[model samples]
Structure formats: structure tokens, C-alpha cells
Target: MASNGVEKVGVLIVGSGPTGLGAATRLNQLGHPNWLLVDKEADAGGLACTDVTPEGFLFDMGGHVIFSHYQYFDDLLDTAVGQGDAAWNTLERVSYVWLKDRWVAYPFQNNISALDKEDQIKCLAGVVDAKVANAVAQGKPKNFDEWIMRVMGPGIADLFMRPYNFKVWAVPTTMMQCDWLGERVATVDVDRAIANVINNKEDAGWGPNAVFRFPLEGGTGGIWKKVAKLLPPERQRYGCQLAGLDKDKQVATFADGRQVAYDALISTIPLDITLRWLGQSEWADGLQHSSSHIIGFGIRGRCPHGLKCWLYFPEDNCPFYRVTVFSHYAKKNCPADGTKLPTLCKADGSGPDSSEAAEGPYWSLMFEVSESNYKPVAQQPTKLGGSAVAAQGTWPAVVAETLAGALATQLMQPGDEVVSVYHRRLEHGYPTPSLGRDGVLKQALPWLRKHNIWSRGRFGSYKYEVANQDHSLMLGVECVDNILFGTQELTLEHPNIVNPRKNLEMKYTREPVMPGLLASAKPMSAQEN
Candidate 1:
């Protein structure tokens, strides 16, 4: 420890994602100016970053649409972009599922018309059986699989829900508990589902994000980037990696060899990473995560598929669970109209050798592939012992896999010129809600708190319910509020509690409140929720 003199602050925030930014903003709002924020990245927006290909095509990590259930979140977004239609595009989420060679209106369990006649009958029969069984059963489902079967029956579960969920979560449904299924899963009504199947009526607009707003520029990351600018520059630090922590000393050390002592630390970094930094290895081992590979493809010409968004690959033509038409969110996401670019290569790295430049408007699609020990990626090696290789036997292998899966399910055509490609692997992409999650958090969080540290965020707290952009931000905001004032840290302690309403008063005209100091040299309001 080369004594740089003790630089103490009221609060020190790690990981400047939405959560960290939220905390800083809230601390500023609460009139607490003695706080510092830092992130490892050059900018904010953790998993919400936008990637730009060499060809000038942009793609978000996956499908990120803004649909807030809290007024506080809404107010922050309005403040970030200013209250106007010009800053955003309010689009009804036109979504679908690709099943049995047809486009089925999403919440696929409700639309059996897309399946074969045999599948349809099997699904209906299962639905009826499930209804009958449910009418006589008592108590709640013990696991997610059981709850899914109870709600959707065997037919729909077998055909869609089970496989699709496994693909998304990269874990078996039986391994997860049912308690986390609030508004996340789409539960289909048996009677309505059967009726719709019988009448062949489509159930299109369903679920939380039936309609959402997208920022006009910079994608989702742009929102938080703008939000970061709203704060006083001196108090924030970006592009700084957190190295370790001296828990007893209440000091956080960064990779640059700088150490900062704090009265209280609000860490939004991954819980496991934080544990490792604090040398708490036992608790770190308990947490689990599924890595995600975000793949983006920019193609020449207008979008061939009429549909705005769709979820595909239940049958394993590809490793991806969902693919978003990223260009649909904003035209500026791709190069301007009439800009010419040459095809890098095909999805399989094979095609006609063309150095000739192509012209006109472009569109892009983003695909998400979940990876874990259970479901590994199948790509080809680019070279010996190199990470740049695509997996072998993956979806890119089959010739018509892309277009057929596209047209047979309706996303694109046979001759859509692919202009650009992008692929990035996020090691801790999603916090897996395994059986051991709750127990680990219970022990780990309190232990850290005893040392004056609060670990929170998507993977930090390891609660998926409050892992979205808005929820993560509120987690930070609430943590600061709890630290500065006696306000409840709703998102951190209770996710469901905060999801239904705004946690704070949203008065735009008035100045925000500030934090007050306390005795014992601790920041006031240090009680944990």
C-alpha cells in the first residue's frame, strides 16, 4: 500500500451499469455529493451495450425493449431522453414463433394452428387433461416444470414451452423453482387456447412487452450513456477496473493501483466477482451463470421479412433461442441508405468471391445463444487453439438453415445478401437461478454487509426478476436511498414489491433531496433492508 493519503468518500459505487448509475443519480438527487462512481468499461450500460461492426452495422446484445412497470423508472427514462415522441419510436411488439414451418403468433402455446394436425390434437388433449388435473390438485407447483405442466399441460409443454425455456435458460425446467415466475412467463388459459386452436384465431399481442418504446439513436446503450452525462463529471470514473477490496478497512482497490476508502460501498459488479475480490471464495463458488454469445448479421437491401420480431430454433437448427430484427428498432443502426459495402463472407464463411461493392439500404438481425455445460455451442475453429472460430455443426452449417428457418418461419429470403457479421461472448451474461442461488445469496450478502458493502445488480444480487435495465437502475437508486435516507431499498431486498409501483415521488419541477450525515462516522441510514 503506497500511501496516496486516505481519500475518503461517503459512498463508492462499483460497476457503472444502469444500477451503479442509478445509485449515483439517486445520491445526487438526495443531495449527497460526497460519492464516487466507477466502471471497468469506457462507458456505462453493462449488458445493454451496442456493438458496431466494421461495415457500420449496429446490434444490441439481444432483444432489449423498454417496458417499465414503475413510474420512477418511467420518469428517469423521460428525463434521460426528454418527454417527447421524437426521441423514441413507440412500436407494438409484432412478435411470432417459428413452429412446424409456419409463423405462429407468439405466446405460442395459445396458437396451435401453426403446428401439425397431430400436434394440435395432442396439445389440446394435454391441455384438457391438465385442466382436469388442476381442478382436483392442491397447493402450488414444487418446480418450474411442474408449474408449466400444470398451466400448459403436456402437449404444449412438450412442443414449445419446455424446449424453448430450456434453450433460453440453458438449464432444465425441473431445476428451477416456480416462485420467480411472476410476469415473466406467459401462461395460456386452457379454454381460450383450445378455442383459438379450434377456430384458428391468432393470439398475437400478449405478455408484458406487447408494446414498447425504442430510442431513436444509439440503441439501448445510448439511453444510459445519456443518463451518465446528466451527473457531475468529477464524481464519476469510467474505464477503471476494480481489482480487490480490503473489507475490514472499507477500501476498494482498482487495477490502476489506486485505492479509495469509503464509509459505505455499493457494488453492482457480479456477486461472484465481488466475493472473489473480497477473498470470500466459499460463497463465490455457490453462484452459477450461463454465458451468452450474441451474434449479429447485417444484410444488404430492405428487410425481406414483414414481421418486426420473431423467436426461432426450438428444433436445434441453431444454438440461438431468439433472434431480433435489430435494424427495425432504428434505421440509423445500419449504414445510411445507398451506402455500398462488400460481403465479408457467408454465415458459413463460404460464398461467391465478390470484391464488388453493393449498394442501398440494409437491415440486421441479432441472435442470442446460451451456453453452459449442459448445452454447449457447436461451431468451427477458425485456427488451431484460437477463440475466433465458429462452432462446428452449428446453425451456420446447414445451407438453408438461415433462409429456410427464415422463410419457412418467415424472417428473410433465399437470396438476402449478408453484408456484415458480429459475435461476442459474455461470460457472465445471465445469472442462473439454480437451486443453490437463494442459499448462497442469503449467506454472501449479509457477510458483505457486515463489512459495509452492498452487492447488487443483475448478477450482483443474482435476481432475474429485477435484472432488466429499469430494475437494475432502481436497485442502485434504492441502495443509495437506503444508505443516504431511510427510504426502502425495494428493488434490492424485494423484487416483486418494487415491480408494481414507483418507489419515489416523481416531481419534475422540484429539486431532488440530498443525503444527510450520521454519527459514528458512518453515512446516516446504514440499516439494511
Candidate 2:
């Protein structure tokens, strides 16, 4: 990379995630050149990247959907992927929860009509009770469990909310705080529920991501790789992991002995790992997360369901909490229609391992299993992009169980041939909003900022509410603004304010007043919070 000596820059951005790219993109747009972005991985997108099977099928890390709340983010995406139908596949979000031997509409509380008569009655009663309780509920929920009870009542909570969330987070609802519950969970309307139940209707449109867009090719990774291409090539360095840090001297050493010192530092790495590199692991006491096992099954057949983009399974029958009908998103997700591949094994792994060549019209399903200290996955799924069946090592039959789970949940038939399989264990997937999270962040973030180091991203800030790509990008954008000028970081400091409203002031035009970024002289409403 760079020469042996330490190369000093005005600003050094670490980790080529959306957050880091946000800062770098802003700097480049401002025509500032005294900055560099470095990432250990060969590619950008971090956890947002897509991996390909040897058989030519593609699977993104997990189920990722773009739902923006900012005009700047929309502009950023359009600039990267090029605007219009040619660059994006804007599809309807046809999501269902596999429960009670049927595909029920999403936001289980709102679509009680899809359940059996008895269960529908129970859910409707719970919704009515929750409405009454919330009318007089004092203060805020003590925890996510309490919030669930107050919002949807115990029936929906026990059947769906509790079990589904536990599967996703691998953390008990009692231990999670409700402050991060702004636009995440759908709110149930008692009147709408009763009407839908009586009329046999489904209320599927409940959240912002009810409909989203994905890339037509290369999956989600295409977006970030394009964004990375937009920046000056000289300033971006890959394959250089941050080995250690000296906060006092503002110096960072890479794995290759290359070093960079900067007046201001922006790190998008996870806070816990960053602290470990800084040799202050004790400050990460409140940080906790669940590892994600992304399993993909590339099969040779037409999908039983049509236009069902993603499905959620809260029942114990499936090891995965959610499964995305990946091939439905884009034709490129699977191999070419006439391409031939071997039938490795059946989904249930019942047959003797065979290498019979097969042809396809292929469809794939991507699954996510959560693993944490509290609730662990049955096995550590094998690394992604390996052989379909050979990657299933001695670690408890994860691929086999996942296949069985899929059959039990009717995601696949008993004889569905597994043509291509892929698995990846992301060490830090979801950042848990534990009760003690605020206490640890208040202590750790300020300490890093005091050393002129700004840490911001999905795992960097450790706030799931602001952990989506758009929010993560804004965290970097605002953090740089905070560094350059004394601007307030609205996305980081106040998620509730940003989540609901449309923030449209940043057009990335014109210059600011002296000493600060009023860029465009058209002020962004950063002080709204």
C-alpha cells in the first residue's frame, strides 16, 4: 500500500461501509482531497454484500430492503445505480408469516383474519384490550416486552411478537429497551383489525419497507461497489485491516505495517472491536449482539408461491426466523435458464451424496438464523460461496436441519433437489438495544470523540434504530459535518425525529458560511431535534 512511514491526512475514514462512504462521498463532493478511506475486506458493502455460488447463483448476506427517509439518501442511491426502471427492480413486498399451517399476512396483529376462527377471536380481543390499556398507560414501556403487551396485548405477543422477535434478536424481549421501537414494529389498530377480520381482508401494508427496490444484478453489493467507484480511486485502500490504534498520537497501524495519522478519525467498525484494538475492551460491557447464519438453497423448480418476496417463520418448525425468496427479486439471482448443474442432494439430505448433473430454471431461498449466548443456533453454518454440500462440516448438520426446517414449513417439498447451497456466519449482524446500552454508549462514544475519533455505523454507534443503510450513511455524513463544523448529528442523537419525517434539505449544492457547512447556503434542519 503506502510507504513504510506514517502518512498523515487531514481526515482518515475507517471501514468502507455505508457510514464511511457517506463521509468520503461528502468530502469528495465538497472538493476536499485530504482524506482516505480504508477497509480490510476486498470489497465495500460490509455485511450488506452479496456472495455467489460456484454454480452462478447469487445470494445477498441476508434480507436487505431499501426504505429511505431522506432525500439525500435517495439522491445518493440514484447517483450510484442510475435513476429509473433500468437500474432498479421496484417490487411489491408480498411477505407472509408461516404459522398455523397457513401463510398469514404480515404484522400478525393487523391480519388476524388470516388465522383460524378461534385464534382470530383471541387476537381481536387482545387488540381491543391493548387499545384500552394504552389509552391510560402512564409514562413509557419499561422494556420491549412491556411495550409489546401494551401495544398488541399478550395473545399476539405470545404467538408472534415474542417468539418472532426472540428468533430474530436471540435476546429476550424483557432485556431490550423500547426506545428504539419507533418505525420498527407495526402498530395495531383495533378498529381496522375487527373490520378486516369480519370482511376477510388482509392488512399487509403496515411499515415503510412494505415495498422496496433491489439491484437487478450482483444483488445489494452492486450499490456500494458503485458508490465506492464514485470516489477518487487514490484515496480508497482495500486489504489493509486496522491492526492497532494509538489514540494519543492519532495514529493507526494497518496489518501490512502501513500507518496513517489524521487530525480527525472516523471509524465504521463495530465499537466493541474498535475498543479492543484501542486496548479498552472493558468499556464495551453493555455491547451485545447476535451472529447471523445466512443459508441459501438454489433449487431446480418453479417456486410454489408467486411474488412472495420474503417469508417469516416464528414457529419452532424452522431454524431460520426468516426466508427470502431471493430469485424472485431478480432473474440474475439464479443461473441462466438453460444452465446445467449437478443435483447435489435433496433438501432433507436423505439420499446418498450424488453428483448427478442437472439443468435449471432455478429458484433460490435465503434463510437467516440468529445465534447468541442466550439462544444459540444448532450449528455454525459453513462459510459462504463454497461447495453446495461439501461445506457442511462436522458442526452439527446445520444445512441438513435448515433443509428439514424448510420442508416442515412447506418452503420446499420433501423431494426438492438442492442444487446449490451457501452459508456464511456474520459475527455481528444485529446490534441489540439492551437496557444497559445507553449507559455504555454515553461513556464510550464521548471518550472516543474526546480523542477526535468519531465512531458511527450499524455496529459503530450500536443503535439499531439508526442502523439501516440510510441511517448509517447519514450517521457518517452528519459525523463529518459535526467534525468540520460544530453541527449537531440529528440522525445519531435523535432517531425518533428522523424516522417519521421526510428530511429533504441536503441537496449537496453551493458553499457554506465561513468555518462551517451551510453547504449550498440552504441550511438543513439539524436543530429540529
TM-score of each: 0.89, 0.92
Instruction: Quantify all predictions' global Cα lDDT against the true fold.
Output: 0.74, 0.83
Per-residue lDDT of 228-276 in model 1, one digit per residue for the tens? Answer: 8878889889889888889988888889988899999999878998888
Q: In model 1, what lDDT does residue 393 have?
A: 20
Q: Which ten residues in a row have the lowest lDDT in candidate 1?
A: 520-529
How does model 1 score by TM-score?
0.89
Off by over 4 Å in 2: 1-4, 352-355, 380-396, 501-522, 525-529
- Indicate the residue-level lDDT of 505 in model 2: 32
lDDT of 2 at 233: 88
Per TM-score, the best of the predicted structures is 2
